[model samples]
Target: MPFMEFVNFYLMPGIVLGSIYALGAVGITLVFGILRFAHLAHGDLATLGAFAALGVVTIFGVSPWVALPVAMVACAFMAIGIDKLFYDYLSERPKIIVVMSSLGIALMLRAVVQVVWGVDTETYTRGIVRPDDYWGIRIRDREIYTIIAMFLIVGVLWAFLQKTKWGKAMRAMSDNPDLALLSGVDNRKITMLTWGIVGVLCAASGFFLGINTELKPLMGWTMLLPMFAAAILGGVGRVEGAVIGGLIVGIAEETSVLFIPGEYKAAMAFAILLLILLVRPTGLLKGKVL
Candidate 1:
């Protein structure tokens, strides 16, 4: 293969993977920003969303594209339920403790998924979309669809955060929860809304990922590190950071294959994360401290 072709193939996978990571990371950052916890269950919540989509596809015999929204709605409901059951009462707890608690929730959720779905790998779409050429580059329909969906969701989310009343309320809560409360912002409602939005985003990301790659019960767990790295790199609580960080991480992972073995691809995000922590712990975008 020519150098350009080789480069394109390497770059494309990274972008697709990074987009998925970015979508998940955005949810993580949002949860962290609004709820003030790490929300470790994010990955599993995403997995749950994927499984929901899988179920939807199975029941309706619908196209993956058609099934996505239904899956996202399931994820949204699950997220709301998780918050209501696990974190709602504990919202006032210490932040670090909440993070650990989130881990516990994550573990329980993972176990529940394993019990419900078993450990077998699953696929959402039976018929694969072959790669098509785009200006001398090759890409799959799933890849194009994922990228388009990501941008659409991100754009809508950005607008919601900036232009809408609820969006402003979310920002206020993220900036200062106590102040928001004093200002008459219902923290409970905001909390539920945040979970809902994050849930939708997580489900969409997981669905795309599962549709592209086979869905294993632990599929979301494997994405945690890269998603975290992307969040931290972009600056926690900053929506743009999550998106850009995901792109950077995705591109870096793909480009690294030029000099490193593919087996090491999983480690690239961690390595970059470590370096960032050492150099600029606040993240590249300088997000406000929680």
Candidate 2:
């Protein structure tokens, strides 16, 4: 293939895919770091966000761009409610129990999507969206929006974690929850805040996915493995690491078509996940290992 062809076909898509995955992975990392369990329902939450945005677009006749924030805020609230209703009660139980509950929650979310949306494949705005060529590299408008939005959101999130008071509390809780609680940090508030952020991130991820591709009830479930792979590859609980890992996995999946069939492209993530587990369990940044 021509070098430019590679850039247009592989590298660009990889970055976009990575950006979407990064949104979800960052949430997964935060959950792992703070709650100390894998949130298996995260992708389903993304699906819910996507479907919620679709509803706004359909009912309000508004552009999906306008509905994005609406869906995010709604999803954030729902996530908080879920935390209070299901996860909070299990707090006294082993963390593993919560993980299983998360899996159950994932199924419930998917069922809701299927019953409401009827498992039909949907899109925000459908048609042939041709890409504009920029110096021999073709790129779609949605692609640009997805990448830019991902950068803006993740950058703002990083800033929040670095410069804000709640961000510090979150970090402290992730590092040592017992000490943080002893220091007078309100554990309940921090937990709620984390879920809120995770819920918003899911909306972002879902919106981008709907924009870049078609929406399906199962799409979010399909993303679960890749999101987890990104989190693991990036290093658990390290925000920057999750971003880097997401990009790597996205690029790897897109480029894998050069040597392997497209059907197995997802295997790339699995390979990376297993490889990281074997060689460097602590991850690239020495993040906490499972």
Candidate 3:
């Protein structure tokens, strides 16, 4: 294969997929960091956000750009509501039990999605997959936009956590919830805010993933393992770790097709995760421990 052909076929797709995984991983990591639970429902939250965006698009017949924000807002509220109902009650329980509750929540949300949208796959645009070239890249416009969006979002998030008061509070809580509470951090409000940010990120991640491929109820769930792997590889609770881990996982999986079957590509992430754990379980970035 020509060098440029390899770049187009392999490099660009890896970056694009990495961006999506980064977005999804960041959300998972944040929840694990601040909320102190694995939050299996996060995948379904991504699915919920995509469907929410789809609903907005169907109702207003607007561009995805317009529908995305509206959907994120809706999902953010839904996340807060989920916290108020399910998580709040179990806040004092053993962390593993809460994780199990999240799994139950995931199943319920999946059932709800099936009931509302049915098991059929759907998309916002009939001709959404427009092939486009940029510089020398053979990619869809959506792919380019998604990658750029991921960088911008992650940058803004880093700035927020590093420079803002609320961000500091979040970090403090993540570092030590007891200390944070003693220092007057409103744990409940912080929890709500964490879910809101996660909800928005989940929406964006789901939207990009669905647009890049097809939207199915189980799609987010399938991505969950890879997303988790990225989080662990980058270091759980570390935002930058998620981004780096995502890129590495993306590249590793895609490039492995040179030796392994494409069907086994997903397993590469797990392999990487295991190796990373054996070496430095805290993650490459040395993020805070749960």
Positional deviation of 179 in candidate 3, in angstroms?
A: 1.6
Tell me how candidate 2 scores on lDDT: 0.93
lDDT of each: 0.86, 0.93, 0.87
lDDT of 3: 0.87
Candidate number that wins on lDDT, 1 or 2: 2
- Residues 172-286 of candidate 3 have per-residue lDDT tens digits of 9989999999999998889999989998888888888887888899988987887888998999899999999888888787888988999999898889878988888899988
RMSD over all Cα atoms, model 1: 1.5
Model 1: ten consecutive residues of lowest lDDT: 1-10
Candidate 1: C-alpha lDDT: 0.86
TM-score per prediction, in order, is 0.95, 0.99, 0.96
In model 3, the clashing pairs are none
Candidate 3 local Cα displacement, residue 115, angstroms: 0.7
**In what order do the candidates fall by lDDT, top score first?**
2, 3, 1
Candidate 3 wrong stretches, greater than 4 Å: 128-130
- The prediction achieving the highest lDDT against the true structure is 2
Give the per-residue lDDT of model 1 (tens digit) for 1-290.
Answer: 68767746887888898899889989988987888778788888888888888877888898777888998998899889977887777767777777787788778878877887788988875666778887878888888888888989999999999999999999999988889999999988898899999999999888988977988888888888889899888888999999989988988888887789989988899998898888887788986555
Please provide, for model 2 over 67-87, each residue's C-alpha lDDT reduced to its tens digit, 9 standing for 90 to 100. 999999988998999999999
Query: Model 1, stretches more than 4 Å misplaced?
Result: 1-3
Q: What's the TM for model 1?
A: 0.95
